[model samples]
Target: MSRAQIEPGGCLILAGTPIGDFRDASPALRETLAEADIIAAEDTRVLRTLLQRLGVTTSARSVSYFEGNEASRTTGLMEEMLAGARVVVVTDAGMPSVSDPGYRLVAAAIEGGIRVTSVPGPSAVLTALTISGLPVNRFCFEGFLPRKAGERRRRLGALTAETRTMVFFEAPHRLADFLTDAAEIFGVDRRCAVCREITKPNEEVVRGGLGDLVSWATDHARGEITVVVQGAPARVVDIDGALARVRELVADGVRFSAAVAQVATATGMRRKDLYEQALAKREEHEDG
Candidate 1:
């Protein structure tokens, strides 16, 4: 197949390759890969295999662009884009810079006034949410949890009151621990789904509360995992209780602002409201 011509100037094309299945790649991707003057692939071997699978031929120059060398290579890639090179960047799977490399290059290209376009493809975020059996009205993508148990718990603590669905990417090895911590922080009863090897032949979605899913992930699980966690239940307004707690914490030598933050975290109240109450309590303390 003949490759479509890319216009002259700094054009940075972020092409999305399939997450698992080869057939999932789009037509535009093949043409872009063929036409790009420089192909900055996450894995050159994978790119070669992908090309073979798609029966696409490319005489374009290939270079490795991943986490280790992303910073250094970004500068050179942007320079090429500025020189009117059609530069194409592809990750081993899915869109680049979505919890992956290519962010630095994209930022540099945009900063240099280059044209950055994308051939949109599959994403695990949307795919997991679609089958999560949780509320998707409002959601946030938290790429990965901290590896250590303590740090992971702290991260989950910080997100305790988040009322939107949360998504995370986890390696198969640590998935059990991640799910266990999630159960502790988000509550054992909180609904969640573990999506594994999405778009692959053995793609599976394990749906259950956090505790149940943790057990399921313990055995016979080896693939990419995307965990979707349901958010905490919304708290009812308790202005009087919140104000009282803030006042007590302040009297106990906790700084007024710090007290307010603590109260907000405990009560799931907006920090702004708690701050106003803390200010009033401080004024009362001074006057009294």
Candidate 2:
């Protein structure tokens, strides 16, 4: 277990690759690439290109470890690590486990008593958030949204009242649709920042309300996209306001019960309390 000895059970290294500019790569990454006995990469071809760009040459065995094959490949990678081989996991970009492979291998490695370490590098999430001109004091990373419109809207609706800033990775082609849905659910006036092709030449960051960004995406927006959205504005919990929202939805053709459920969910209020209050209000209005 000494530093000089690659014990019968070695360690797993989770290396972070640059999200855009290769120059942002750390020296630790180079050392890991050169020293790892086995390199599990999301894409071997892309790894080769990165190695070439960094002028790094290694004798380690390179294997594909992307989403499509990660499950099947975990066993073999774990076996190598348990057999005293230094295994390094790298995704196409950013850290391996964040919206990428390496989770399975890391978990298996730990379960097998193997050590796991990371060589941190540039992250699209952090990169976009810091430069997004949005509040970063408290934020959450929502990797990607459902591709289907209905499902995406439902998922977004669930976060309509989220107060913490949110970050999301999105495909260039889906940028417009994603923004459009976000605008409708989060509101047209909600502030957001769309960062594209970060760190590389032609990088662009569009900051504005959801409505303005949607209009911009209609004509521009390409490359890797990371969106930072301002959290919902803070509001005091008001029973009257909650009831009003329920009534509005009910007027929009939603069933009274369903509207109560939706408003309760969005406002984090007790559904029973909202239902009771709404019912009383309706009865009073009808009597008056």
Q: Could you estimate the TM-score for every candidate?
A: 0.86, 0.90
lDDT of 2 by residue, 88-164 (tens): 88999999999888888888987898888788889999999999988889999999989999998888887877899
Candidate 1 C-alpha error for residue 187, in Å = 0.7
Clashing pairs in 1: none
Worst 10 residues of 2 by lDDT: 1-10
Q: What's the lDDT for residue 231 in model 1?
A: 85
Candidate 2 contains a number of clashing pairs equal to 0
Relative to the true structure, how large is the alpha-carbon lDDT of every model? 0.86, 0.88
Q: Distance from true position, residue 199, model 2, in Å?
A: 0.4
What is the TM-score (0 to 1) of candidate 2? 0.90
- Once fitted onto the true fold, the runs of candidate 1 whose alpha carbons sit more than 4 angstroms away are 1-6, 239-263, 272-288
| Residue 259 alpha-carbon offset, candidate 2, angstroms | 4.0
For residues 1-288, could you state the per-residue lDDT of candidate 1 as single tens digits? 423354566688888888998888788888888777899999999999999999989888999999999988988887787788888899989999998888898888888888888888889899999988999999999998788889887778778778899999999999989888889878999999899999999999989899988878899468888989998888786988889988897779978787788779867888997798768876887899
